[model samples]
Target: MDKLEEITSDGVAVCQPGLRLGQLESEARKKGWELRMYPSTLVKASVGGFLAGGSGGIGSVAHGGLRDFDTVRAFEVVTMEKKPRVVLHEGPAVHEILHAWGTNGILTRIWFALTPAVEWMQLTAAFSTYEEAFQFAESIATGNTWTKRLATVFEWPIPSFFTPIKRLVRADKSLVLIMIAASQADALHAAAIAAGGEVTFTGAFDGPRTQPLLSDYTWNHTTLWAMKADPAYTYLQCGFSLTECREQFRKLRERYGQEILFHIEFMKNGDGVVIPGAIPLVRFSTEERLNDMIAFCRSIGVFVANPHVNYLEDGGRFRPDNIQLLAKQRYDPRGLLNPGKMISFRKQVVTK
Candidate 1:
């Protein structure tokens, strides 16, 4: 099942869901193409698992999210029935199974949209202040001066937890990690200098290298590193208004100080406008304090995708999509798939 069945000339990858995202990427890169978006856990996460559970990562800076980029051309789902049926969904219909946590149907095959491969260079920029680091990331994300696959910023002490590349980074400096086109290296260097930052590290990221990749220090992996460093750290998945993110960051820093380490991933929204998504590492003292902090984030227009809760509705940043529920009813009528994860299923059952 973990096979890369085909790579078409038009840049589409037809593969089994069991294929690891990293393996798919490597195979596609060999064919001069690459996945539109992938999670930071690409090496270990399967194609189906990412489609079912992950929102976005890596290439999202240029391509937007998995849902937004029209990245999924089709899905082949296996329904849970007395006689299970193989179903193929195309175009907009694929969303029925996307990010649903496998509560609707099991994915067997996926046709993913791919882009022409670029020789991406991994680089890290160090800044004297967190604001400078963020502004540097913002310039690359919003401007066309440099094409980037990833742009992630870490505030002060957060960089301290990235021990693998600790020698390349200053302990006191905030950091901006990027995976940009090798062609734009000079432009990126100049831009970093203009932003009051310096490119601390730069290397070629050509799939499965000996050295540590900057990507491993990004997205949810930032939280992973922090947690490894100190078990007291948990994380919050959040979104900030594109226009108001600077002020929001200010407010969050003021509120939590060093207690909540700021880690931001700059990416394009569904509308192709760049926005900031956060996976801030929180110093976990109690469940009450974490809940209170989440409430406070919501109060300030910072959208919190509450990861603390298990229910689908509670964890998602957006309202429950009716498409997902309708799919569940059609594919898993008995509510046998994934059991209690989908709160909407239980509600629909009660209403009957």
Candidate 2:
């Protein structure tokens, strides 16, 4: 909100912090604009980081990922005019100002649209077998069975390891199924159970009423602990329908075998590209699961854009875009203002 207020006031210049809430994006989408935040808006990442480095979190799945949401209106840029070279540009010429690899101009502020916020509710079901749990996960996420939010389901290869808390889950074959509902808990609940799941509602009132899943969202920690085999492990983001996801998912499970621990978080995909972490960050022992996540991602072609893979590798910083951006470092031919990062990138640079 600070960044939003800043840009609106024309004083503050940038943003992107934590997991972006769908309610916020949906609200923005109504006006024909959306912003994809990395690590999330909740963490409050700077928009400069978001624009400079393509990153995303909870709000990505439905918001067309990152670049898709930004349709910049005008630029308050420095043009070459005697001592002050700032130009207000129109049309594709704005490209000279944007994606400049960080040199052509300093992006102080921008004017964009807002989207509608998606109201959501989360649901879960625990089963006794991987097939049962994965089946329901696949089933619910199949045809947009639920609106606004996606079903996040996981299977415990060793259900007994979870114990009484784990026992609440079946025994050796239990599967934990989770889904999100817009408002109809009863209807969504019934649908999940009917499709072969043992359902449970995770959240309960501790204070006053707030919109359910949409109000306070969480979905990543679950995947991290359960999917990331080791604490040192990392993960990546990808887009695939239930069918495509499952096909590749099976291939991953079978090919990697025990070497890789795999799990998936499901989220609704419409216009935005999101990273859906389990509601409310919860940490369970995920060390063993993470070790294989990185390798698994490469196997599947999922791009993991954390600080490691992209940054830190250019000549020294290991960023090539910085090198390209160096040519257009100045809005004016003679460099005056502080220029952007001058380095290189190791990964591929994509244009929108």
Candidate 3:
């Protein structure tokens, strides 16, 4: 099942769902093409798992997310019934199972859209303050002059947890990690310096690389590093309004202080508008305090996709999409797939 079946003339990759994203990427690169977006767990994440559970990661800065219409071209699904039926979903219909957490149907094969590959460079910029690092990341995300894949900011103490890169990171400095097209490395370096940041590290992002790819320090991996350092740390998935992110950042820092370590990933939304998404690590104190912090974030107009919950609706989406519900009814009518994860499934059954 872990096979790269074909790469179409138009740059589409037709592959088995069991293929690891890292493998797919390497194969794509061999053909001078690459996936639009992939999760930070690229080395271990399977195509089927990513389509079922992930939202966005590395390349999201330029391509939005896997859920975006253009990212996935098609899905070959198998129903979970006796004498199961094979179905091919194309275009927007693929969203019916995208991020559905395998509760809709089993994905057998998938067709992913690819783009011409670019040599990317991984680098980090250190700033005197977290705010400056954040501003610099936002500039790279929203600016069109430079083509970028990742733009992440790690607030002071958060960088301390990345022991592998300790040599490049200063104890007192906030950090901005970036993956930009190698062609724009000079431009990005000049911009960082002009914005009062120092380019602390830079290296080739492709080909034979170091043990820890710089990407491992981003997205949810940021939380993983913090947790590895101190198990007391947990995280929250937040989406700050693009227009109000700067103010939201200020408020969050003032309100939580060291209680919550700020980490930001800048990416485009479905509509192609750049937004600041956060996976901030919270110092676990009490259940009550955690809930209170979540409420405080909501009160401030920052969207919290609570990661502490297990239910599908309670996590990122907050509510099940009607399309996903309808598809579930058709593909997994008995609700045998990932039972109990989709709260809406039980509710719909009760209502019926």
- Per-structure clash totals for the candidates: 0, 88, 0
Descending-TM-score candidate ranking: 1, 3, 2
The Cα RMSD in angstroms, rounded to one decimal, for candidate 3 relative to the true structure is 2.3
lDDT of each residue in 287-338, candidate 3, tens digit only: 9999999999999898998888887777866334478778878878778999
Off by over 4 Å in 1: 317-319, 347-352
| Model 2 Cα RMSD, 1 decimal | 8.6
Query: Model 2: what TM-score?
Result: 0.56
Candidate 1 per-residue lDDT over residues 117-164, each given as its tens digit: 998888889999988898889888888767899999999899999888
**Candidate with the greatest lDDT versus the true structure:** 3
Name the 10 consecutive residues with the lowest summed lDDT in model 2. 275-284
TM-score of each: 0.95, 0.56, 0.95
lDDT score, candidate 1: 0.87
Better of 1 and 2 by TM-score: 1
lDDT for every model? 0.87, 0.42, 0.87
- Per-residue lDDT over 1-352 for candidate 2, one digit per residue giving the tens place of the 0 to 100 score: 3244323332222333222333334334344333333232333334443443433344343443333445444445644324555555444444444433344455544544334333445555676565667666655554444443344544454333333244245544444434343566677677667867677554432111332331122234443444344453333344434445556656766755644334445544434323322221112335444435545654675533332233223312223444334334444344332333433312223232
